[model samples]
Target: MARNGRSERGATIIDVARRAGVSAMTVSRVINGRSSVRPETRAAVERAIEALAYTPNTAARSLVRSAELRIGIIYSNPSAAFMSEFLTGIYEEASSTGARLVLLKGEGGRPPAQAALKRFRKSALSGVILAPPLGETRSVLSAVRSWELPVAAIGAYDVDGVACVRIDDRSAAFEMTRHLLDLGHRKIGFVLGNPDQTASAERMAGFYAAIREVGGVEVKVAQGDFSYASGLVAGEQLLGGDERPTAIFASNDDMAAAIVSVAHRRHLDVPSELTVAGFDDTSAAVTLWPPLTTVHQPLRRLAAEALAAVTAAASAGSTVATCRAKILDHSIVKRESLAAPLGGADARSDPDA
Candidate 1:
């Protein structure tokens, strides 16, 4: 309602511009979070926005700038569950804002940014969200940097000029490892994530740090590509060994679920014969036979936040480098899959030595 006391249905951007004594275009820029707006002018527009209680109409905004607000997501990740949750977040946010999201991928496993660039050139997308492996690729990042559109990468590792939204993968893995250690499991086998992503190294470092802190723990390691199949292979190697570990920690839920399946095939009772834990508490974590004791990573929230940054940059005519990272918290989620070693079997020697 107007301060002059006539009945008002809603305040519009034109009303805000009139109140702020600026052009409608300038008000639009301010409303969109553009970096180019002068300080005093921005403040004036903000004040007018607050005074008039103006809220941009989503329908009208979409009608006006639909062509300029297209978003692209480039990914080369192998996890189906992770991608489903990620895309859900992006779609929810994009739909709310009347923005469109376009899925893109590399051809013949080429650099993702190359495919992204082609899509951008063809349709002039406003920005892009790059998922893991693709997000961490140096060539892909460099290619994206050559364009004017903003880029937001998902995961803890940062690119030179891209905004990121992620949980601390290393710390989360450390917490999970420490949990297993505290549970009296010393002979622990570690399954690594995909080597192409920096997160693999970070998670491995965290696991090693925990082992080092608690001296004299025997450790076995296996490599995985963050897939169920790779986990099956890694599981066979670790479990088929002469001296199997009391517990296994896989880098992701899919891999850990595979470990559980392998245990079943070997007639080993989970948490009785072996304990397994995983990272990323995706749906597979809960759906597993015993449910997974894993790190609770907020995948959907990470995606939503990443998309928010990308959209903000698109609307504001700003680069992603100007936006700061949005780092989120993670925690260890305990389930039936983890427990103390049975009857002191394969337990560490000397309780407090």
Candidate 2:
């Protein structure tokens, strides 16, 4: 039974199905974590897999297939820092798997994404990966699904029939807010990301949740489109007022860096007169004078995971059926940008400090 020093008669999906007394499709559904499968059926499939030592041959299938694997990436995110890290992840993964990547800039609205999908329809693309904002766009998702292309979404949550990879934005934001609160910052300002993305809403929700947990805290909200320019405007609005916040948390590092710039212009010492925090530990977070205390969102890993999921689904020739959601981990990164307020826990009494 040995071939090339390995077992030639290795277990396959059919073998697992036969051992479990179920159809191959049922086994596949169980393997992909589809909710439609009954608990008993899922358990049986797991038991069969364990007993037979059956492993899905994604790599072998890809190698045997004649068509080259081409993956399309459509993105419209405004943050350059975020995109740089995201593309790095995708490139790294593609190089390892020998998958070709086709890039498309979806700057406008649904038209760009839809147009990209239309172009990909004729390009022999094996699958597509939609970056944030575009990933959450209903029109774009519907259009891609209509074309019957294997698709995965990055930074989007709970999209039916699509493989999704993201961190818990709400939870991450909540933890970051808690960190500021623990540092004795009572008056805090928040800079929001683009309104079109679901992550913006989730992050805002987390900020409010933490704020609600504490009483008598003053909070100011400003809008930013996750761009450095937008961050500058938001930072000005937040710091220009007479009753300024003791700390500010931006939705992303770009905005946080902008806030730092604004603070320096106003002669405020970071972590002394004012504390700043940001989400997504992108390049901007560390490059600034004082490193940002922020949420560590694995932008590159998210992109890589999404690409891998869609490519694997395409390899199996059942993208929609095999699509699954994966939630990655996020952590709070502590750095010099955050500290206790100037007057510590009693800073609120002065307000002008």
Candidate 3:
């Protein structure tokens, strides 16, 4: 039966469940994706939805009246290059879903990008996606959890009330480190992300794991705040050693590029003399001096998933949950900057071995 618009009552939730051959609660949860539901069952529910001609009544006054929504995308980083790309992806995703994107770069006259974290409580948002320091900070997580608003973290942080949508930093870091090992690099150095960032901790775990797995290499690491300056500080440390790391893997491309600058200062040719690699595959990765071999983070997809979550959640008002945290995969891209430690970095390298 084709029901007309406006006054016509859409099919009830029970009808959808009946057609889908599942309980109404299952139908609700499948739509929500909050609790665990079988994939085939979820697909079947979706098909049943189409068959039942179901359309959510978001415009209904009662549905909209449950709770007012203010979605916030909060961050603590303000570096121009990395910050810009991250914000751009976030804005693109959030804006598309009709959620207002509050920059939350910090209020008051703060010195740098980090102070913004303190203001998340004051901001008017029902749901928030925290970036970096905000995503990982214990204080920030405490403040956010206290707010009782739904939050999706962009990295790996185990806050009780928060959900995470991020790559497995340990595995990604391990794989990247193994790549360098395959290139016959023994003295590999790592530049870590901000000490407070959980991803940094996980990434370090992976970096250490790679070194341990291969054995016979001196382990070394330097600290960075995931910024160009942080990279500079860490890069100098990487290069200053008497027995320098044959390859350096900075936590992110910004640091990697900074290390490239360090290499230039020492007149060491890239890849051939000293290889470098990074993560996040930001645009700056491509623009680097020989470019960088790095991990491809799916920022756009991540943002969209966050947006979809917030959008569905906000639209759900206070009627239980309508959406949840989603996971996505990252890839690795091999560019010019990473080659061999005087040898090649291909299958002949046998990273798994």
Candidate 4:
């Protein structure tokens, strides 16, 4: 139907094929994202489609389809390993549902968050999922509200009304510490992450809880910012303290590796002289000499759960408010990094003695 001839509802693919001088089948292949269409042919098909204002027939197809897709993932992390792994979950989940992952970079602080949320509305993304600390923020939560977008926060700490897919951080930490205590590690030191981080706080509570359960064992807690340098700085002080712990539980593997490095420099033998453990069984945990005992979080699986939850929420036409928390299990991975303290005079003796 020509624009001048009649008031047609819309142009069809036949109109594009006629203008491009290609068979209707070739035009259909290009439009459907099928392979084997030549570059020149694809280009001509696109041009003719634009010229005729031809949109796809997905509307009719969608009526028969049982799925709604195009999921949006929001990450406030600096482009890094953790974020990359999180996105892998998003992609895998989206693929299973015949959807695409529309990732949003929310790296900057509050101002960036506002701008990112604003830009999010301009796109055709269906639902949004928040990762970690970002999901725990007041500003981000408020922004999510103002944007009128469906948002699910993965790894949320305080979820009064928020939807989250996270693990029991406090319980995980408690269990890991209890495992060490059961192995006869009484005088254990802790290298913690930033106080502002909810996981760090929860993990610290777990360590202290274990100490309280056994009664009378000293707890030396060092502050770290979840970085190698922070670990190095804090670890040195803890290692050189008057009552050095026989075993040190770092908040994460990176800091644990730093503790291991510091121990090596001081000529302290691992497991034989001192034992070290860490949380968040990151890659470095297994690579350290003798490796590290840590709590293994199902990062990828948790991520998939978060994405799937968001997908389900959007597909069900429910507000993100309707979504609830999901808890994943964690495991304790033991390697050579843990052992009974060296006997008597050689084992973690007091500096003042």
Per residue, candidate 4 scores C-alpha lDDT tens digits across 92-122 of: 7667656667766654422246766778757
Q: How should the candidates be ordered by TM-score, best one leading? A: 2, 1, 3, 4
Give the candidate number with the greatest TM-score.
2
* Error at 198, model 3, angstroms: 1.6
Clashes of each: 0, 0, 0, 0
For model 4, the stretches where C-alpha displacement exceeds 4 angstroms are 1-68, 77-81, 106-111, 344-353
Q: Give Cα-based local distance difference scores for all models.
A: 0.80, 0.83, 0.71, 0.71
| Model 1 deviation from the true structure expressed as Cα RMSD, one decimal place | 8.5
Residues 70-95 of candidate 1 have per-residue lDDT tens digits of 77888776776777888888888777
**Cα-lDDT of candidate 2:** 0.83
Which segments of candidate 3 are over 4 A away from where they belong?
1-42, 47-55, 58-69, 107-124, 319-325, 343-353
lDDT sort, best first: 2, 1, 4, 3
TM-score of 2: 0.82
RMSD of each: 8.5, 7.6, 7.2, 13.5
* lDDT (Cα, tens digit) per residue for candidate 3, span 147-171: 6666766765555555566777888
Model 1: residues with Cα > 4 Å off, grouped in runs: 1-68, 107-120, 321-323, 344-346
**Highest lDDT, which number?**
2
Residue 351 alpha-carbon offset, candidate 4, angstroms:
23
1-353, model 2: which lDDT tens digit per residue?
34852247577766676689865546756776768779998999999999988888867665735566898888877778898999999999888766889987866433375655687678777788888877888877887788677788888878887877889999999999988877778899999998988899999999999988876789999999888888999989999999999999999999999999999999999989899999999998999889999899999888877876666566656545234567889999999998898877675443432
